[model samples]
Target: MKEISCALRFMFSAEFWAMGLCWTVSLLASYWQLVLRRITGRCEVYPRSELPRNLPTRPVCIVTGATSGLGAAAASALSKEGFSVVLVGLSSELLSEAMEEIRKRNKDAHLKGFVVDLSSFCSILEFKSSLEKWLTDSDMHSSIQLLINNAGILATSVRPTPEGYDQMMGTNYIGAFFLTKLLLPLLKTSPVGSRIVNVTSFTHRAVFDAQINEDIVTGKCFFRSKEYPYARVYQYSKLCLLLFTYELHRQLNLDNKPWQVSVLAADPGMVKTNIMQEVPFSLSNIAYLVFRVLGLLQSPENGINSILDAALAPSHVSGAYFFGGEGRTLRSSALSYNTRLGEKLWNISSNMFFDLKLASQATSSSS
Candidate 1:
């Protein structure tokens, strides 16, 4: 009887109660932000008409995956800020719809839609060519003030791209890497200092024990045969993104160019988005449902603030990881800070791009 009573006391200890209280308060806060504020339309930083206008003076911001969810929200906010916003996505129809939706809120908003499938390196290169052509046609060599690498996928099954690489890794990390590399000239030439915001996630912390090489090189680590869950694969991809961000920052500083470019990683808190649609009826789904019931999911508007914060931060804050809406710089995983690992990943990705380019050239010659 005494043992049972002692166990009960321990279970109800002050530390446990305090932890429970903190979690409850966090849930309530999330609910208020996601539900009440969103419904009231009070979540936006600027209303239509109040957003800045006049593209010549305003900065230009390029946002990938801007057709939906947090990407759309961030693009809209940037439009409000009077930036010449470029929305890049896979669907022309969705891009049109997204631009129209932003214009509905701010009729004077300057927005352009460009369709590019981030999962394909060739598609990204094509996008770069199209962008250059458009700029040339417009007689505009304007520096891009901000580039937001936000396109990503959460695949339930292991699907490799035509390049024989994991779809998730290709889209989430390599695509962004190649795109950023291709656009480095534009970013460097911007009249004002440039910023690159890579949208990462807190789930990257889950990759502490992951085999990074297998995941990035062959996608074997994420195979169903290995029993590695889809969620973990997504997390691993984000981990690679964070590493890329750090490495890019290092390279930018090394270049010592007059036009400064800052690289930042942003972790948007879990937001209500269609990203979860790919998850089947599994423990992941059950956990998501539990989070929803507990009011732990954030609104898309709130989720994007961290990204915006990173994009608008001062140049000195480069190589920093910002968290949630607060936009506070936080330490990422220890692996993320490993310079050797980052360099290795960079070399491997560069080699992959080189191999793809070689293959394309060979095929063209043969044809």
Candidate 2:
């Protein structure tokens, strides 16, 4: 009875209306830009070639969230390009499905699948250890050429990751940051022009300065489902990702020992994905109507064009944000470049993972 009463009260409260209004405005602002691009005929689709390459050696492309949606699309496309694509998903079964999907597109697709739950620190560390051993065993002939941090979620519930952080923030930003940091040494050994593409969104602009804090990661800010602003939380996660993208890009080129690797961000503006399914039926239904009515949602293939360009286009510069196709680029939110906020976020996030490094070592030794 109490739970029901609380839900009912929240549904009728001013907070609920305020949240809806904010989401509606953000959605319009973000999608309208894409709509204008489409109207101006600036969005052109990238084509794929199916021929398998017989090169002496191939570079590896690691794409997370490979089981479905844009991630799976990216994995398949990279495989077609003759890169030895390493597909990362949350489970072995999902990885198998992704590999199978890729092979269906190109029977000769060079692909490998690995399971790494981004929301779990132990899982990430274990996967890193396994990948390191694999690279060593394989004689280091094929180093990672590209990494796409594509796995993300828009969580409506107050679910905590295995590491007790907000699941969305953990998966969308921290997990990507951790995985990229762990792989930096390997990436340094990669081909001279290796690249890292951290996927971000325009929705990041929705998060204001005051909302950017450690509480976002500590899970205190989004602890209650009834009052949780799902759309804003999604924006918060993307904002953190954009900040990481900028800081990492800056750090990589710092101190005169510039890494050959290029770090960039891609915004696939309003793609159709399973992320919205987690929202309540009322909200999801409204979003669906808006998507259909405004022609705002795009297919995974159409959406990944920006991502593919970021990954494959040699002309791209590091720290650039690919906002749309046809070589379009845009400055991300002004707040995304706030160096102080970026440094603070970097320190906190790095410390969070560093704090877990000891625990991970202990657990592995025990096992």
Worst 10 residues of 2 by lDDT: 46-55
Off by over 4 Å in 1: 1-57, 218-228, 281-289, 292-295, 361-367
Q: Candidate 1 lDDT, tens digit per residue, 1-367?
A: 6645644543455533443344344434433444555576644332112322333566778999999999999999999877879999989999999999999999999888998988887888888888878777666655677899999988756887766678888889888988998888898887657889999976676565645464445575555464435555677788889989999889888886722888989878677777766533342355456667865677899888778778777655688777646445556778889888888888888877788778877977999
Q: How close is candidate 1 to the true structure, as a TM-score?
A: 0.80
In model 2, what is the error at residue 160, expressed in angstroms? 1.7
Total clashes for model 2: 0
| lDDT for position 146 in model 2 | 82
lDDT (0-100) at residue 115 of candidate 2?
88
Best by lDDT: 2
What residue runs in model 2 are displaced by over 4 Å at the alpha carbon? Answer: 1-56, 140-142, 210-212, 224-226, 255-259, 281-286, 363-367
Indicate the residue-level lDDT of 203 in model 2.
78
Q: Mind giving the per-residue lDDT tens digits that candidate 2 earns over 1-367?
A: 6645645664776655655566556657755655676788754333322322332467778999988889998888888777888889888988998788778779989887888999888888887788877777776544577889999987756788888888888899889989988887777776555789998887787777735567776566677555666666777788888888889889988836564777888888767777666545555566667776877668899888888877865523678777666556666778989999888888988888788997877877999
